[model samples]
Target: MAHIPIEAVPYLESAIYLPMLLIVLEKDYELIEHGQFKLKRPYVHLIEEAKKLAQRDLQDVKAYLKSHYLKVVQGERDELFTEYHFHYKQILEVRRYSNIRLRNRVEELLNLYLNKASQAHSAIQ
Candidate 1:
């Protein structure tokens, strides 16, 4: 398996959404490359769903660092990523959730990451 350092990961809040966001972006890229690109409706819906959460102050310098890392990786300022980048920065500034919840969500997101990976592999096979 490939390795990624903890410090390489963007804002802590991103651990919750970054994987999902990357999956969406990957799908978008695939569709475009296949010349089947539509409006990317599912990606749009995911963004909307993420935005439905109540506003909180999560912005911080650390979050900015992470988001900037992601922007550099993507090499473009797409709307979905840019918005999440902004949100993560906000979250870093002001925490809205408890530690216990944070740990649980991290676990949940790990499962999501694994599930998505498996499904993608199956699709390719």
Candidate 2:
């Protein structure tokens, strides 16, 4: 194991989980589109905006990882936790996250990133 930079951890974790978030968002969008709702536009709009923001952030995360020469690889998995291998330069660090924890963290990060994006947009307007 190697010492991983604290600053890089979030981006590395995002790299592992953002795609999962995006897929869930996509499915939710479809479900909302077909499900019963009094006003679907608002829900649809929110999901669309969230999706766009998430996609943009994911791209930024990828670029940051690339520039920093950091790579994250999915490792072994069992019924409980999943392993993620982080590669920086010639060093390798492995982190294990439980399935429940991974889901919770991704949800937290989604809200965090979305709020950050919304705040930045508001400041610009």
Candidate 3:
């Protein structure tokens, strides 16, 4: 008896398929036919898990984008600074490190928001 390698299990599962056609003569088995190949059976579960993880990451990113927009409008300078400090690399990359005009425009908008929030806060006190 030969011991089967565990690593070969995935390969075997991937190759496993329903025979489309079988030609048998007299009682002895003849040809076994199959169809187009696809990913291993075990990998289907893993693929689904990976898709869920990707969707979760995308949702987190979207939430962050929306929160950033709202925070700017609310004049949360401290929070904005913290967020930008953590994501400076991403910011630079997204803006392509070009277009000084755009950068300045972003700064102006943030400042405007912050001032408005501060004024509103002071009025409440």
Candidate 4:
């Protein structure tokens, strides 16, 4: 698993919600004809949960984006400090890692939802 920076967690979390939900629903269609759509699927509940999570994360995302812009004050003297801030690098790392995590979760959910024995029943007669 890759590491996502704390600052970018909410943005990544919110970003995953829709993609995950879409993958779930699309799998139902793609797998249904192949007799692998679950009869008692938790799609509704899963969507609700995703919605809640997205809502929470969206608030954080908005807050972060809104307040993240700030001007750093530099001292007249730069002889004492040589290190510089790496906030942009950290954010990039977080986005990269979060994307990996999202892709992994999508694959996992697809396998679990479409490969279940209980899901081997066809919706179409």
What RMSD does each model have against the real structure?
Answer: 14.7, 2.8, 30.4, 13.2
Error of 4 at 64 (Å): 1.3
Give candidate 4 regions above 4 Å deviation.
1-42, 70-102, 105-125
TM values, all candidates: 0.30, 0.82, 0.27, 0.31
Task: Identify the runs in model 2 with alpha carbons over 4 angstroms from their true place.
Answer: 112-125
Residue pairs with colliding backbones in model 3 are: 75-114
lDDT of each: 0.43, 0.86, 0.30, 0.44
Candidate 4: C-alpha RMSD after superposition: 13.2
**Between candidates 1 and 4, the lDDT winner:** 4
What TM value does model 4 have?
0.31
Rank order by lDDT, top first?
2, 4, 1, 3
| TM-score winner | 2
lDDT of 3 by residue, 8-106 (tens): 332222111101000011011111112233634333333333334334444554455444431111112341231111122123211121234334543
Off by over 4 Å in 1: 1-12, 15-92
User: 14-62 in candidate 2: lDDT tens per residue?
Assistant: 8988888888778988999999998998667667777888898899999
Count of clashes, each model: 10, 0, 1, 0
Better of 3 and 4 by TM-score: 4
Strongest candidate by lDDT? 2
Runs in model 3 deviating more than 4 A are 1-35, 70-94, 97-125
